[model samples]
Target chain A: MLRALRVASPLAVVALWQLASSLGVLDPSTLASPAQLARTAWELTRSGELPHAVAVSARRAALGFALGAAVAIAAGTVVGLSRVGDAVLDPLMQMLRMLPLFGLVPLFIIWFGIQEEPKIYLVALAVVVPLYLNLVAALRGVDRDLVEVARVLRLRRAEAVRHVYLPAVLPGVLVGLRQALGLAWITLIVAEQVNAGAGLGFLVNNARDFLLTDVIVVGLLCYAALGLVTDGVVRALEWRALRWRDGGETA
Target chain B: MTGTDLTTPVVAAAHGVRRAFGDHVVLDGVDLEIRRGEFVTLLGRSGSGKSTLLRIVGGLDQGAEGDVRTGTAPAVVFQDPRLLPWRRVLDNVALGLRGPDARARSTEVLDEVGLAGRERAWPRQLSGGQRQRVALARALVREPDLLLLDEPFSALDALTRISAQQLVRRLVDVHRPAVLMVTHDVEEALLLVDRVVLVDDGRIALDEEVGVRRPRRRDDPDLVRWRTRLLGLLGVADA
Candidate 1:
């Protein structure tokens, strides 16, 4: 019953929205109706424009996320594991994260040009903050008792990290992964806007010139879809990695 | 396990050991020794430095004020079990344990602890008693000369505690490692250990030999008398 209500609530809203559009209570130019948006989306998909934009956006997001996550994990581990590293690096990391990163898009374009470099860098910077913070917090929260166990086991530093630290950090890392993926999409949207070139942002920008509200709506929906898809992927990963997390012990 | 006689070689020894966390000293000038194939329990209240002493002896803590040495890096079973939740029962048991036979030995120890077929289970999937058993197996799989236990049974319920105790006692008999267990339970001390070292005011207040025969009863008069003495020493009314 609850699941049905959950599904029905969103459906009811869409139904109401479409009704408003059909009755001409809403203007398509002002705000495209759901049906018009769907038509535009289908037309764009058939012309291969939507697929090309999605591919371009995905490549940027994936590359930036990959680069950002690698650096964050490495730095988070260093700062998490060593006091000197924490003292030296954590404040620096926090400072970098605290900056209004999006505001730097102008400077980034000037420095790296309004090329792929600036956009990818913007997305990477956006992805870095969330993953790094979550990872550090998770590492700090590791069971010290298990570290003692690692010591007693006579595991080498690397072995201890592999068996103890890595697994312990996984849940937090997955949480970060979800956040970073979401941010990567948001960052890419703003990034591709500056370039006014190939990507979902370009499609939306191009539609605005011709007042193609339905096509712009389609682009917006694509961005939201990208966010949901990445989140779903991370959620699936979390489900697998944390299957051993406490639910209830066998009696 | 029935502990061996005093003639056996000492597996671990500590002298004038001291530990302080910032301003507070936990273990002060504490000296203790455990013979091979012996079972010793450090009897102390919370904050009495029994665990601090154990950590020092187990090589988990460093920068102590005095000498502490063990024949080999000791195996420890903490109250929390400390099994990696990500590792299955068998992997946890085999962790950091080297040799081509490590996996087989881990299986044997799991069976010895009565967890024969549950090797594939995750640590979080086990009950508290079962998890503690896995921790014990993890320690025993190493075949260390010294086993350090930090209140290993304090987490279990009454009935499960008894079973876990029996399992430990049986494993000690089979493996014959020198065991140093820290606990506040006087009855537990009397039931399992060959000697009880009372820790008080950050020192060894008393190191009395139990000298009781194997399979001691909880209500045994000798044990009762010692419990009363210990309770009094711990400043209990013993009413």
Candidate 2:
């Protein structure tokens, strides 16, 4: 009940703002009441423009996040397992990770020419560092005693990895994915604003130029809604994947 | 017994086993022979390297020196139950088994350990004693010729420890694995082992045989005598 109230409180505030604006107590042109934003969002949805923009942004974010996470996890595992791999790649990765994704926008635009390639590359760059760091830490945190038990059982290297290491590192990987998802969305918005021909970010940018507060409000709300939806999907998948983890009880 | 074959000794010999971690020598030229169906407890103080020796015997560690020649691979139970948290009780028990027979073997072992109805229970849901029983089941599932127990019941409460010890005794009687348990508890050592080996300064100081019969009472005169001797050998003043 408390959780539901907390969620409803924000919407209630928006409703109150709309009512106050409709009563002429507040300027709708400056603030753009919730009702106005809703009407604008409905029109955009009916015209299929909003849906197309959302589809493009979602595809770009999903593809970039998946590719980045996969590569980072593989690289992190190699770096964690071998001393040579760690020594050779650790310093280089640390340097690259320190470089901000937005700071590389100009170079990305120059290289990829303001196309979808640059925007996707920006999203990947934003996500890879956190995923890599989390995966490496997780791999290092694998229990030595568990490995010893596997050795005593005479488990083959592959069997040990499958039965022990994978399960042990899963929680850490999920944490990274959660963090990466949020960053991917934020990066997608920024990349779209700068280079995207179509997206929620492009819509918001277009509204700003025309002083269309309703469109701007609608775009921002859609971004928040998209973030919530993606996070929900990831969390649901995490719960399903780690069902053996104390029956989905949060630790 | 139908499956009893007592002609050959289970663990052949431990010849001049010397283990050292850098400057500190844990086991120094230790030689011992464990015969089939013998409950030999290695009693020592903390850091006396009895656990280290047990690890070497269990094939979990390689000694700095010496060779352990055995008839078959041993199954070990650590002080911690070491059950995989993600695995069910039966799956944890089946950890040591191979191929398709693992599930049936695990169920049988769980039944033998008096946990017949707890095959689907998770490790976290089990009590300390029950977890150790699962660990025992895991070892027994392999049908190992030698069972190496590294203070398996030490972490449990007194009541739980006693019951677990009794369970181990029953399992040993039925399966007849050559058992070597390392423990710091002298009374627990006296209660469980057929022969007690006192280790001090990285060497076996005393190897005494218990003449008392099965289900021996703690207050037995024979046990009292052996305990006194063991305490003296361990440099503990008699109470």
Candidate 3:
């Protein structure tokens, strides 16, 4: 019964929404009924237009997220481990993280032009700060007793990292990945709206010009679905990697 | 050289070891020597620099001014069982070991430490005594010439502490490493060690040999006398 209620909750919301639209509590031109949104989504899917836009957006998000995560890990490792790296890089990073990331979109467009490069760069820039900050904090927070044990065990530099530091920092890194994924999607949406020639944001904007509210709703739902799917993936990774933690829910 | 007592090899030795932290001095011209198969306990108050000396001998810190020489790399067990939580019990024991035989060696040591068939258990799943047993297994797996223990059993409850102490005594008899344990517990020092070196004000204040026979009772007259004497040195009013 509880499981059925879980499924029914969303259905009930949609049913009420549909009823409200039919009763003219919501204007059809401004807010489409769930039925109209479903029909538009089905038509877009059948015509392959929705899928194509999704593919483009997913490609951009994947490329940008990967690049951002890789650099953050590398930089965070260096800064967290070495005194010189912290002295040279940490203040600069802290300063840069202070500027609102959304405000950088215009600067990125001016620097990289209004091509796909700017969109991808915007997502990377937005995602990098959270990942780097989280990873650095985690690395610094590794148990001092464990590190001392590694030393007493006579673990060399590389062995200490493998046996001690990496595992200690991994849960935090996964948390950073979740935060960065959310930020990446938000940045991608704004970037696409500001300058993209194609993608889901493009679909939403195109529908808005024609005042097709149902199509707009479908595009927004796709974005929401994508966010949930990516978050689930990160959560699954956290579960497997941090299995030793009690209750197994580090994320 | 002391001609009368040079038969057993000195496994670990410190010559005039001195350490100071800025204005405060922790260890002042402390010297120690441990022979092969000897169990020595450095008994002291909380700030007596016993742990500092252990760290220097363990090669974890070398900021002090002194000569510290060991026959082989020493193994240490800290107050807390510092097992890597991500690794299983077997892997934590095998942490210092390398090569393909690490697993087999770890398995053998776990069995010897009475934790057989618990290889897959995480550190958090084990009881406090069990975790310390894992730590002892880790140190013993190295077959260290000198085992430096820094109050390794202080965290356990009284009964668990006794059992863990018995485990250490049994393992010491079997492994025969030159052990240097630092602790404030006078009874613990008397029960486990062959020699008790009272450390105070950064120096060895007393070095007494325990001549009590094996499997001796806690109420034994000689053991009680030594315990009272050691507790007095620890500044306790009564035994």
Number of the top-ranking candidate, with lDDT as the measure: 3
> Residue A104 in candidate 3 has what lDDT?
86
Residue-level lDDT of model 2, residues A1-251, one tens digit each, is 99999999998898889799988987866878877877899999999989988888888888888788877877898898999999998888798798977988999989999778888888887788888898899999999888877776767888788878888888888888889889999999888888567888888898888889898888888889989998998899788767776543321
Clashing pairs in 1: B1-B169
Q: What is the TM-score of chain B alone in each candidate?
A: 0.95, 0.93, 0.95
Q: If you score just chain A, what TM-score does every candidate get?
A: 0.94, 0.92, 0.93
Q: Write the per-residue lDDT of candidate 3 for residues A65-163, one digit (tens) a residue.
A: 988888788889899989999999999888878988889887888899987898887788778899999999999999999998887888888889898
lDDT of 1 by residue, B178-237 (tens): 899999888888889888888998988998778777678987887888889999999886
Candidate 1 residue spans exceeding 4 A from truth: A1-27, A31-36, A246-251, B1-7, B16-30, B202-205
Clashing pairs in 3: none
Q: Tens-digit lDDT track for model 3 on B101-200? A: 9999999999998999989898888889999999999999999999999998899999999999999989988888889999978888877888888889
Models 1 onward score TM values of 0.90, 0.93, 0.95
CAPRI band for model 1:
medium
Give the worst 10-residue stretch by lDDT in candidate 2 chain A.
A242-251
Stretches of model 3 off by over 4 angstroms after superposition = A22-25, A247-251, B1-5
Q: Chain A alone, model 2, TM-score? A: 0.92
